[model samples]
Target: MSAPSPAPVSTLAPWPYPRWIAHRGAGKLAPENTLAAFRLGAQHGYRMFECDAKLSADGVPFLMHDATLDRTTNAAQVLSTTASNTGGDHPWSALAQLDAGSWHSRTHAGEPLPTLENMARYCIANGFFLNIEIKPTPGAEEKTGQVVGEHAARLWQGQAVLPLFSSFQPEALAGARATAPHIPRALLLDTLRNGWLDLARQLGCVAIVCNHALWDAALVAQVHGAGLRALSYTVNDDWAAQRLIHLETDGIITDRVDFFSPATP
Candidate 1:
């Protein structure tokens, strides 16, 4: 058989996301992946936000970072009557009833989890950019990716800046590419492996979001040379941010939204 065709060139326009993105909305300051966090991030002058999207059992797309709800929500106390440990096992109605914010602090009591559509409307209405990390349930990577991509495409139909999709799973990214090729994608890497650039190219990725320590001047230059942006995540300290800035990285995801001024970067 002939060789498989190479991935098509990315038609994505220039990168529009801000260099500084508030991680999980407002990071540790508020309930992550909740509307409260997003609003707090905005209050701190963040223009771009990064959140995780996964599908419930009923296939409704929602904002949640973990596979299980034990850490972020009172699922155990509230859903004790149910046998579901994973968020994907519950319908949207059940998931909606769980208090997603009370675990963070009493101040955010009763803050419910925000659906992907809820986030989309809020961001679109306020002209905010988003980096949507497709965090799928086990064995459902492709399905989650496709659904989230389709939803994002429809949600941001006429918006100027589409949500940037990123994932550590290649299958998910592939599913996304098949479902909505117009929305830009990025490869998320916690550890740099050999031929990563080739993999990113094969996946038609516009950027590579890496662990903050993985980036340096040469790597940044190499990614730029390959026509893809280089971004680092969870960068909270001044030195790390300064280092990434010095390397001329394209984007920086940070947990310290209140500490780091997005306006400067």
Candidate 2:
């Protein structure tokens, strides 16, 4: 028989992570990036979660999505007399005392921001997977990435699968890579700029996290062809989830933890 073309070498790498991930812990069901949200996600059977991580004035990596604490925390009240209410303007000691959960709802009132170390402990103890998105303050991109990456490396040293580090800022990814070269890193893409693929490769990313709408069959093949996994974020609806599944995208970050069973995915 004609030599069978060496069984097409599989482009897919060994992805140890689960297919489904909970967005900002439990998404809108609970306050984003709070430990309570993670607890609730676990209750709904989610094994993996994605959260935003940024540094405080003292450089402690903690969870919160916005640059200003105004939207998520009672910053206006807590920082009433302070010169600045920006999250990164305060030390973690001060940041921690702010009510992070009350903004979402009264039930989560008094919830404090969980440090990355605190998150590491919970996930490691419960055998959960995490994707930490390095969210840098305006002027602290590289520093935030370095700090978060260093902390993550130290925290999950012996874990089988280290937490994934992802960011839209290339410099942030570069910093993380410098600190924790062994931990897997992914490039977060909101839009396909020129030579995006080349940039991702340059950053040594194992995966590409994109907005759900940006994905299609050709793009999946393109990413796979480059030996990278294609992952989508904020995929909430059933139709979109089905589409990614159909296209064979490697991972899905979603707010609908209850709608999609992680156990089955």
Candidate 3:
């Protein structure tokens, strides 16, 4: 039962338990954001998968991290035909041809960047929960959120696990809220300033996702006080895993999925 409009930030549901989450799908194993990564994460027993989402020039939502296609894709080399398309400026046609998976390995050579709808279909059909980080290109915040949010609303139309939308960009989060208020949102921060909680409250976020180094028990308690969850990202070791658990963080987004638990492998 999807809501016709995005819920007020205050009305979002509490996060489901199990703090261990897979970062960018399977992290270092599979090409991040590809279906392969998600499957690998599932094999590792991760119920939740986190990923970044940005809009292709044609408005398609694809998985990517940097604003430019240079680092991860073959866009810098093979697609030098248009290497100048920085950040969110490239058209979908150009992006679709980039070798998205080859840099990872040959086995994943043909893997193209996945659209939000494609990733959603994979996640839902497999009974997995999602934490989508709205990574908008420099000036594409509103557009990215609207496109991804609309696709998410359509994909999880009747699912029990409402997707968790998170972002460092307030505009992106706000746009997502405006587009699909029913889904939950989390405010991602590297450092917690004095008014951070108030800002999170204004954005209608139900959680705060902080860089692992910045999280502590006091911050966790502060988040809880505001009726929100506190989550951390990029944790890669057992010590940090135990630490987050001890702090009672609601969830952790990590690259080292294998270290967290025993699921498939």
Candidate 4:
């Protein structure tokens, strides 16, 4: 009799492989948060995508990296082009028309900013997971979190494809917890400050996403001790990636999805 085929591999946790993630969709390849960028990442074999989200004035959750539209879009120029587009600050009507992708490349010209709904639809339809960073504009933290959480709840309702919502704003995370209790949330830290674990626990975070440099073996173990997953950001090299793996980190967010040589496929 023919030998039985080897048992199927288990894709279980500490997860199935090393935690290499793509930052801002595929890094600087395609415009960040645009559908094109996500599609490009899939072509490169990425199963997870990360992007920033904030609320428009009308309370629509939309993808954007900056607090203002000046950097990634032609908002300022568009305002200059028409008197009607001019507003005191952050006028939603004017902000909506700015071509968010043109600044990245002429080829991506006229690509409009995408809504959270749009992004959710795309990710779910494509069998991809997401990391939605709740980036509130200055002084909009509580509202931004509540609105985005509600939107995320409605979008991912009754589906298994819930996005991992994250933010540096602790209050935002708390608000998200109140608004969408079912969605998983991560605590984002740019610095390794005292009392961070207290804050993370208070917010009910499932993971702590830090700037990789902020973590060493000790910190990774401490996080795990608290029953929290440890995730690092912007890790783009083999040595750094290996170090994190050795430290037993839960995930690594990287700009170079192309070079992430994980131990397993």
Each candidate structure's TM-score, on Cα atoms with residue i matched to residue i, is 0.94, 0.97, 0.90, 0.87
lDDT of 2 at 51: 97
Best-to-worst ranking by TM-score = 2, 1, 3, 4
RMSD of each: 6.6, 1.3, 7.5, 6.7
Q: Give the clashing pairs for model 1.
A: none
Candidate 2 stretches with Cα past 4 Å from truth are 1-6
lDDT of each: 0.92, 0.92, 0.83, 0.80
| Model 1 spans > 4 angstroms off | 1-13
Clashing residue pair totals per candidate (backbone < 3 A)? 0, 0, 4, 0
Which candidate gets the maximum TM-score versus the true structure?
2
Q: Which of the two candidates, 2 or 3, achieves a greater lDDT against the reference? A: 2
Q: Residue-wise lDDT of candidate 3 within 79-170, one digit each (tens)?
A: 65745757467777878787778889998898888788888888888788889999998888987888889989998998987889999999
Model 2, C-alpha of 21: deviation from truth (Å): 0.4
lDDT (10s digit) by residue, model 4, range 1-265: 9999998653322333236567888888888888878877777888788899887766778888777666788876777653432122454666668797889999899988888888899888887788999998778888888998999999889886588989999888888988998888899999977899999888888789999888897898788878788899989777887788888788888778667743333
